[model samples]
Target: MTYELRDHTADVAVEATADTLSALFAAVADGLAAASAESVPDEGDRFEFEVAAEGREALLFDYLDRLIYERDVRLVLPADHRCAVVGPGEGDSGTGPSDPDEWRLTASARGVPLDAVAAREIKAVTYSEMALERRGDEWYAYVVFDV
Candidate 1:
């Protein structure tokens, strides 16, 4: 897992890279968690969710947005995640993002309760300066958020 927090004026920018799409998404989720909480508590509950989009970049956006939504709804900070890219059908695995409508994701996310962690409160995940692309066999995404 590789990620960095780049300075983005009023907001925060996260750049993540991985050998696979699922790992890339997980890194981005972790970056968000790191930005939101000072330290993510280890003893937290895990939950699963599925998110899909017409394109790889959109999928990343929805994946991060879902984590934020879960945080606000459950009053928890997502500390970690494991994800897999799949075909359109449930439980179907894929080689990773290739087309707009062919890829989807299933993610298991762990969360530390809001009261158990120091929260920074990320407002939303923004598309401004956001991108997801393939660099050789690795995948990379640069996302900006409204903090």
Candidate 2:
């Protein structure tokens, strides 16, 4: 997985890619960790979740929103993830948990201390021109969040 920060109208923009959706989400978590510049404790604190959306952009937004919510509400930082498409279909709608193109993600994350450095607070995931697609063997996504 890989992540890069870019200029955006919001607090920041993130671009991530991976061989699989799980890898992509994991990379996005690492990117979020990097954004905070905080050292996440390496402990086995696992969480399970499922999200569905009408399209790929919505799915991506939901994925990130879950991460942010976990951070804010649960203080969890994703360390590893495994996502698989379980449903059928194509494109965004096809790429979900219930759809034929659905994906199921199981992940392990570290817990951030309450006294950790405060970074930008992610308010919500945005659909302001988000993108998700596949290029050959890799999956790619671009996301913007309201801070």
Candidate 3:
């Protein structure tokens, strides 16, 4: 998985690519964490969260937004991300084995105390220029954050 920070006029955009959808989510999460601090320690307190949505793009937005909320409330710089993105009808019996219509994301991350990192304030994650797509065996996403 890989991600790069894109220059935005008054914000920052993260473009990430990964081999799988779940890894893509984690890469984007790592991008957001990098946007918050210059350097994040490898070790931190464990943090877990979940979000559900009708589409992948919206789920990405919610996931990042939640991280921002967690950062502000818990006073931590979230990092070392891991996540799994599941289906819209994950538990429904009618869907059978075919792909479901909705999506869900469950993420586990390490959070370093805000005081321990040299940090910057990211106001929020925005929908402007946001994107998510798949090409062949790879997944890609572009997300803009209101810095």
Candidate 4:
């Protein structure tokens, strides 16, 4: 998995790529964690959450939004992430991408309390220019956050 931060006019954006959809989500989480703090200290605390969406686009959006919510509500700075594309996602049983509400994401992240690290708050994740797709052998994601 790999991720990079990009300039998004008045906001901040992340470009993430991975060999699988699961890794792509994890990479995006890692990018968001890095954006929250200069350095996320390991060996702190752990938190896990699950998210479901109608489709890939909303899945990505909800995944990031969920992470941001965790940081804001729990006052934590994430250091590590583990994400998996679980359940019968779209196109699982020769049904094509017709059902949008059947996809789910299971994520586990570790972090320290916000007071223990220097962090920059991310206001929200936006849909502008948001993308998730498969190209060749890699899955790519592009997301912009309202910072």
Candidate 5:
């Protein structure tokens, strides 16, 4: 997975790509971590989260929102995640065993310390012109956050 940071009006734009949706989401989270300049601790607490969206765009928004929530609200910086979509029709959404519509993510993140000056706060994840697409064998996503 890989990501590039772009300038935005208010917040920041992140473009991420991976071989699969799950990897894409993970790359997005890593991008967020990089933006914050906070290292994801190798040893930390684990949490389980589930997000449902109307479609692909909303799904990506919700997924990123969950990660931001963990960071801002729960004060956790996730290092790894296992995500899978539940329910759907076909393509991004499927009736097969693995789909990319709805998602359940189990993540490991570092806990925020009381005197951590290096940690940066994220206000929220935005859906402003967010994009998710599949090209050849890779999956790509573009997102902007409201910091």
Candidate 6:
């Protein structure tokens, strides 16, 4: 997986590419976490959270939003992301990922509280220029953060 910072009109954007959906999610999460902090500590508190969406685009949006919410509520700068994607998500019934059914993301992340690191104020994740798609053999994502 690879991620790079991109220039944005007023905020900051990140573009990531990976070989799998899980990797893609993790890469984007990594980008957001890095954008939110100057550096990630070697050790941190680990936590898990879940989010469900109707499609890949919304799933990606919600995933990033959840991380930011976690940061604000817990006062932490999250990193080391791991994600699992499931269609017909937990309690739902559907055909598959393309079924327009619920898709769930169960993510695990690690981070140190704000007091342990220098952090930037990232207010939220925006849909402006946001994207998630499969290109050839890789999955790509582009996201803008509202700073």
The candidate that wins on lDDT is 3
> Which pairs, if any, clash in model 2?
56-92, 87-100, 87-101, 88-100, 88-101, 96-102, 96-103
lDDT of 6 by residue, 1-147 (tens): 999988798899999999989899999999998888878887788999888888888999999999988988888888899998775634533334444467888889996788887888888999999988889999999999989
Candidate 2 per-residue lDDT, tens place, 21-110, comes to 767767766666666544555554567666665555556677677777787787555545544432235344333335455543344456
Summarize candidate 5's per-residue lDDT along 1-147 as a digit string, tens digits. 898877789788889999978778778877776666545445565676666666766777777777777766665565565566433553443233554444444334444432443656667778787888998999888888776
> lDDT scores for all predictions?
0.84, 0.63, 0.87, 0.83, 0.67, 0.86
C-alpha lDDT (0 to 100) for residue 81 of candidate 3: 89
Residue 31 in model 5: shift from native, Å?
1.2
- What TM-score does structure 1 among the candidates reach? 0.89
TM per candidate comes to 0.89, 0.72, 0.90, 0.88, 0.75, 0.90
Tens-place lDDT per residue, model 3, 69-132, is 9999999888998998886655753324544676877788898998889998999999999989
Off by more than 4 A, model 4: 87-101
What lDDT score is found at residue 91 in candidate 1?
49
Ranking by lDDT: 3, 6, 1, 4, 5, 2
lDDT, residue 127, model 6: 94
Worst 10 residues of 5 by lDDT: 86-95
List candidate 5 segments past 4 Å from native.
86-117
Error of 1 at 147 (Å): 0.6
Task: Give the 10-residue window scoring lowest on summed lDDT in candidate 3.
Answer: 90-99
Instruction: Compute the lDDT of residue 140 as modeled in candidate 2.
Output: 85
What's the true lDDT of residue 77 in model 5? 62
Instruction: Kindly indicate the candidate among 1 and 4 with the higher lDDT.
Output: 1
Clashes of each: 1, 7, 2, 1, 1, 0
lDDT of 1 by residue, 85-134 (tens): 76445444544544545568889988788998879989999999998888
